[model samples]
Target chain A: MNLISEPGAGALILRVQEERIDAAVAIQFKDRLRELTAGGEGPVILDLSQVTFVDSSGLGAIVGAMKLLAPSRPLELAAMTPNVARVFRLTRMDSVFRIHATAPETALHVRAAG
Target chain B: MCAPPDDAALMPAMAPADCSALRGGDDCFRRNFRAEPLAVRDALRAAVARFARRMGPDDAGTLELTLAEVLNNVVEHAYAGLGAGPIDLTLCHAGGRLHCRIEDHGHPMPRLAAMGRAMPATDVACTDLAEGGWGWALVRSLTEGLAYRREGDRNLLTFEFRPACR
Candidate 1:
């Protein structure tokens, strides 16, 4: 699991560079998120444009990532594909986290206008 | 043609017969793989590829995700502490629904609690929200006809999916 971190304005954008984030890579994802955001002090927006699939374990890993940066920092999700969106809806986790329909910068504008 | 990863476990021998049933090259897929993450992933990719041309995108995605949930559970629970064991998966589409049967020589579920449980509570503090126990919900919501049985040393789980397109 390759995660690229881009420093946004007062926020951090973490991009998942894998096609699938299921049981095969959930632990790696959690460990990598911890490593990338160590000592970071801002809301982290996860860019899931490249992720085509995320199973229950992957969703748990994402939630774990959020709890890891709790109280001070937040982990947000962006650019959810249809399949990814379905998992969130079924688990009711979509309402728990802030979701974005577009990429990082584009979602910012969409949120502002809508 | 290039074979999928972990081709040794896939039994695509019936490919020609399966193709004769429908317009595309899918009606059944069978594989016997070790209950491990990478092996499960390979089986899923192969199954999706075999059925992709017959179903719509959402149905295809549904199949992959639901199968992942079921297969993952089998690995984490049934095969726990017993090392990776063999899992048999057979998928067939007929009468406008996809039928799935998975078998393994692992622990039998005590009561088939997966389909009986409700979704975990979502109305909670951010810090208190549950992270796991969500797979069963997805599995139940995505498929139907959930049944489980243990025959001798093998455990059989049967389920069905009604394609939204049908």
Candidate 2:
């Protein structure tokens, strides 16, 4: 469950290093994402290009990470693989989160787009 | 040295049979796993990959997602407090349809009345998104024949997927 974090201009780009996010690492994924974004001041762009699959538990974990920073920081997803994106589309979570083609450089893009 | 006779000439000739006739019969797969989340995930990945090789990737993805939701539910709710237990999974494919039956002794199926089956509102703001309730909805949407029954101490859930429908 290695996550590479890079602080961009006004956003934190957290790239998940795993190929699959399923029941096995759902809890660990949420906990680690929470820790990484706890002190960040701006929007968070979650890079999921490496994640090829996501199950229901994994979807829940992503939503849980968002709730952990509700009413303040926002969590956006980017570069989801086709299989992973299908899960979001099937569950209609694509409507709930701001999904992007790729990780944006700054929080300004997120704010401007939102 | 003398050359060996041709293999095809050495054997008796046989007529070709219908491929559909062979595919029409049930092809069954069964496995039992410890009611642990990681084990469940690994088993599902392997099984789904095998299925994909046989039934194409699209149908396999649907099956994988639905089964993941069901098995994860079993691990999270059924075997929650109880120690490791055996979870039985059986799959049969025939006539362009796949049937899956899962059995567990840990807990009876939860009452639908208690746990609502409604799809979470997708129109809500990002800050107010609900995550946990979407599993069942996706299962119902992707599967054709879904049935659940608790017989004695066993919880049996059966679902069917018609790949052609997708």
Number of the top-ranking candidate, with DockQ as the measure = 1
How far residue B94's Cα lies from its native spot in candidate 1, in Å, is: 1.2
**DockQ (Cα-based) for each candidate:** 0.22, 0.16
Candidate 2 interface RMS: 21.3
Score residue B114 of candidate 2 by CA lDDT. Answer: 30
Which tens-of-lDDT digit does each residue in B112-136 have in candidate 1?
7666788877777667767788777
Docking class of 1: incorrect
What TM-score do all the candidates reach, one by one? 0.87, 0.83
Q: Which tens-of-lDDT digit does each residue in A1-114 have in candidate 1?
A: 899888877788888989999999999999999999998898888999789899999999998888888868877788888788878777777767776666566343333455
In terms of TM-score, the best-performing candidate is 1
Off by over 4 Å in 1: A105-114, B1-26
- What does the lDDT read for residue B160 in candidate 2? 89
Residue A88 error, candidate 1, Å: 0.5
CA deviation > 4 Å runs, candidate 2: A104-114, B1-25, B114-116, B125-127
Residue-wise lDDT of candidate 2 within B1-166, one digit each (tens)?
A: 1111123111112223223322345677788998887888777877786566665555667788888888888888888798768889888887767888999987776676533487777666655667677788888888877888889988898988776432
